[model samples]
Target chain A: MPERIMPGGVMSGVIEAVISLLLVAGGIFVFIGSLGMAHLRDFYMRLHGPTKATTLGIGCMLIASMMYFWSVDGKPDIQELLITLFLFITAPVSAHLLAKSGLHLRLKHADKTQGKPVELRPEEVGDKPVPHPDKGHG
Target chain B: MLSIALYITLALVVMALLMNLYRLTIGPSLPDRVLALDTMYVNSIALIVLLGLWLNSKTYFESALLIAMLGFISTVAVCKYILRGDIIE
Candidate 1:
């Protein structure tokens, strides 16, 4: 009869399986995010797609990297932690600024699936009526 | 075991890179392009980290860090340009 595998071997196998699952799951999330980027109609909505995916997906990949390195060296591997930190910090801010700039440029939102702009009342414009000579002309 | 994981991660990263390229190519608006470029930068950093793992070298982390820092600056510059029509003004 073949000898049974040791508990330690089984445990290692389980850990490896978990890491593999994480890598595949992260990849799927990234692919979905890209699909969202492609399918979304408006630039503002598209901004969310990659930002969410890259942050979370890169995070998952970094965790897998840290785990793999720690297992091999028998010590904590911290470089991935730094990369994760950088991603978390920058992704949102960059996305926000990009979206804001898009709005500032008055780029027409592409979701014409909805109808024309609803005109706002004078009070809605509030505090600042049309710039005297510049309005209803340009 | 480690090598296998590294290769799998590399393949995934390359796939992600291709997706970003698609976004960069066909993005409808300027900000859309910028957003794709930003995503590409982040993915590139992740790719570098994976490469470091595959090569068993700590040195590649430096490039990863540089990518992160420079990537942010570039995004900010692009955003500024979009908002003001000039990066410096």
Candidate 2:
């Protein structure tokens, strides 16, 4: 545990302002993501939002946190960095997996969603493409 | 100043969680539900990090890290099960 540094100056105020800005921006992005998830008409379109939340939204908040701790503790906290990196890596992978599964399940897309996957066969997906619960629907 | 911003962000995140819950409850497809869950956990991590900042403690970072790892693994596992019928093959 590093000794807390109580830096009382204009820099402190500036850092706080920055952190506040980051927090508000991150919050807004997160809200927007969820809003899209809730209101978007199709599964594929819905998937578009959360990836933003996971990357930019969480990324902003994490940076603000790192800045917060560094100013207060006088040492850069690496845990937030770890989370940021892990999210940047895993968010895309999970999104890919979700999209793949969606395609496997034949999830319906909005009519406007373009560049649909063509000729995706079930056997081509996995060793055995499991019969999904929503097998009958589009 | 910091506290005010934290509160507003807190409210936004909590609302985000609620929206996620709504999607989880009524998502038309399995992947949508899974995506909702994934987003839920990520939002929770943000909430946890914010809590740590508000309380001025460092302990929450470990929990946030753990949640990130677990969330990603669970999502991948569920997706694998959905695709292949078996989790580990």
Scored against the true structure, residue A67 in model 2 reaches a CA lDDT of: 95
Q: What is the interface RMSD of candidate 1, in Å?
A: 4.7
lDDT, residue B60, model 2:
87
What 10-residue stretch in candidate 2 chain B is worst by lDDT? B80-89
The lDDT per prediction is: 0.71, 0.87
> In candidate 1, which residue pairs clash?
none
lDDT of candidate 1 over A1-138, digit per residue (tens): 122233344226666667666666666666667667767878867877788976788788778767756655667877779878987898888987886676665457665533222343332222233333535542
True-structure RMSD for candidate 1: 7.3
Question: How well does candidate 2 score on lDDT at residue B66?
Answer: 95
Measured by TM-score, the strongest candidate is: 2
lDDT by residue (B1-89, candidate 2, tens digit) is 77788889999999999999999999878999999999999999999989888778889889899999999999999998898777876
